[model samples]
Target: MRAIVLTEPQAVALVNDWPDPEPGPGDVVVAIRAVGLCGSDLSVYDGDRAVPSLPWVMGHEGGGEIVATGPGVVDRHVGQRVVIEPNYCCFDCVACRNGRTSACDRRRIVGMNDPGLLAERVAVPARFTWPVPATVSDGALGCTEPLAVARTAVRRSGVAPGDRCLVVGAGSQGLFTCQTLLAAGAQVSVTEPHEGRLELAEQLGAKRVETAEVEPFPLVFDTAGVPAAWDTSLRAVAGGGTVVMIGMSRSPVSVSTRELVQRQVTIVGSLIYDHPTDFSATAAAVADGSVTPEQVLQAGSHPENAAAAFAKAREAPGKSWIDLSSWREESA
Candidate 1:
């Protein structure tokens, strides 16, 4: 089996003799069809974030079809197209019991700490995989994971129909966040340095600003994941408002305790997303045309050039995607 392995920091290798994945109980072996690179994947690659070990597989956002099922799996079947949730939580954990599975005591992200799907196939827990409509393309399905992240940020903000909101970046995450906020009936505005992204933000129904210098809004979303973006979000949010952090920046930033306390600001740290329900909502939104995740996709690369695909991810204006359908069960 061919797999793209992150052999070390800032380096990746294509190994044609990589070991094949085997499905365990309650798991399914999926013949991967597509993958989307995320900022967090770059963080792991740059050694800005630490996983359990090295030589790790390097993609998270993905979709494909079931090729084989393990024991105790009853719902999914071979040949069913689906989107991979990537994150799975232990049901018996305290967080799961309290309906906060994203914070479960025992949770693992498939492509970060564990083995990833940047390969010909992946064996993922059946509970973390969701079936998609037959009409959904593999590229569109691969965009589900990040879109789910955006949806989670909006849902966490608790914005009402008329609430004014500001998103601090116009990247893919920022655009998706803006679109999700609009779908929730909130008035949305965006701040970005890139002219092209700001235009795309406007096309997606968001007001544009050169920076976060205008009037403060009741809710602010920070997708830039940088210290400056965090500071700007803090300043752009109205007193007693909420600022949701949606990016995966590892650097530390200074904060004003007095300002934070005086204004009664509520800061939230949102990660990937919750299981079942969050993905369920995202898939539904994509299906009904309430959200268009595919709009953020860039040109895709085939498996033969997967290493080059990752090399170009950091520079892609939109979501960097890889088409892995060549390795589908039928093709394999």
Candidate 2:
């Protein structure tokens, strides 16, 4: 099997002789078809995001076909098309028991804690695999993970039909958030410093696209983790409204407690998706054309050129994907 290994910070290597994955009980081996390079991948590559370990295979947003199943895996079988959920939770945790799997006491992100989908094959727990409709392309299916995150953010915002909402940033996750809000019948507005990304946001159903300055919205989502965007989001939400923080930011910034108290603002930090619900909902949205994946994924690179793929992802306004099947031709 061929895998792209993040050998060290700012280094990526494509290794052709990586051992193939062997599934455990209740697991299945998936032949990865398409994998999207994420902003987190860039963070890991640049040493901005600390991982549990290094030299890790670097991808979690992917979809593929099931090639084999391990013992006790009955419901999923060979030849099934599926998207990887990526978040592995400890089912015994109190949060998991309460059906809040995203908040499980011990959760392992696939690429960060375990081997990721940036390879020819990956072994994932059957429970973490969701069957995707054939109507969706492999590249589109690869986007389900991020779309799930977007859906979770929108759900946490409590935005209702015809409500005014603002999303800060026009990156892949931000654009997906905008579309999710639009699907929920919210009047969406987006803020992006980049002109091209701002236009892309409008195409993704944002009714208003502005350059970082905007009126107060009843609901606001901060998908850009920069301090300025955070400050803008905090100030952009109307009094008594809600703001959801979906982007990860390591730097600390000061906030006005008095403002929050006086205005009665609701602030929430949304993590990854809720296992089956958010993942399934995102897949359904993709299949139904409610959230167009192509709008966010603008290009694809062969996994053999994994480094180039990462570079494209870093520079491109949209998401960059890796075609994992390309290794077969190279090996042949």
Candidate 3:
């Protein structure tokens, strides 16, 4: 098996002859099909994320075909297409018991804490596998993880009909947030400096696109971790409106507390999604034509072009698709 290993901070390599995973009881092995590159993965590569794990395969958003199943797994069989949940939680935890597994104190995110699916094959618990609809493409299915994050934010926002929503940043998660808000019937706007992503936001259903030239929004969600985004977000919030901070900023963000206090604005910080099945919901939405993941992502990238994909993502133009089939071709 071949895999992308992030051996340590700031180091990544494609390793060949990696031993293929063997399924344990109630576990399953999936043949990787497509993986979506996310900002969190970039944070892991850049060492901004402090969850200490090394020599790990770094991908949480992936979809694949079941190659084998372990004992006690009878509902799904070999050759079934599935999407990985990528969330590991201690069911005994208080948060888990409350159905907020994303907030479980003992949660270990695959690719973040455990070995990830950015490989030829990935082993995971059968409970974490969601059946992928035949109507869904592999690339779109792979994005279920991130879409779950956006979904969670939308779920938390308590968005009412006809409310205005603003998403700050046009990154992967930010664009998804915009789409979800629009789906909820909010008048959505997006703030992104990157022209390409701003165009994509418009394509994704944003009513207004704000660049350096545009004015501040009334309801704001900061999906870009930059302090500037936060600064703008605080100013953009309409009185009694909400601001959801969804991005990861390494440093402390300075905001005017007085402004928030004066406006009676609500500020909420959304972590990741809590329910493993949230990924399934995202997949269902994709399959049913509510969410189009392919429109948000560009074409797939081969191994030779893999570095370029990472570079392009870092440059902030568009999200990249890692085609596992490309690895097979490269090896051949």
Off by over 4 Å in 2: 52-54, 209-213, 328-332
> Per-residue lDDT for 193-295 in model 3, tens only?
8888889999888855555544554567889978888877887877888888899776788767786688888988888887756766786787688877676
lDDT of 2 at 98: 84
TM-score of each: 0.94, 0.95, 0.92
Candidate 2 colliding pairs:
none
Tens digit of per-residue lDDT, candidate 1, span 182-223 = 889999999988887788889888998756256888899999
Q: How good is model 2 by TM-score? A: 0.95
TM-score of candidate 1 relative to the true fold: 0.94
Model 1 regions more than 4 Å off: 52-54, 329-332
lDDT of each: 0.84, 0.83, 0.79
Give lDDT tens digits, candidate 2, residues 1-332: 67888988878898878888899999998888888878887888787777777678888999888889999998998888888899998989888988889998799887776677888888999998888776778788678889899999888777799999989988888988988888889999988887777778888779665545578888999998888888888889889988899887778978889989999999899988776788887877777777777777776787667887786676578777887656533533
Q: Give the best candidate by TM-score.
A: 2
Q: Lowest summed-lDDT stretch of 10 residues in model 2? A: 323-332
- Which candidate model has the greater lDDT, 1 or 3? 1
Per-residue lDDT, model 3, residue 221, is 83
What is the alpha-carbon lDDT of model 1 when measured against the actual structure? 0.84
Native-referenced Cα lDDT, model 2: 0.83
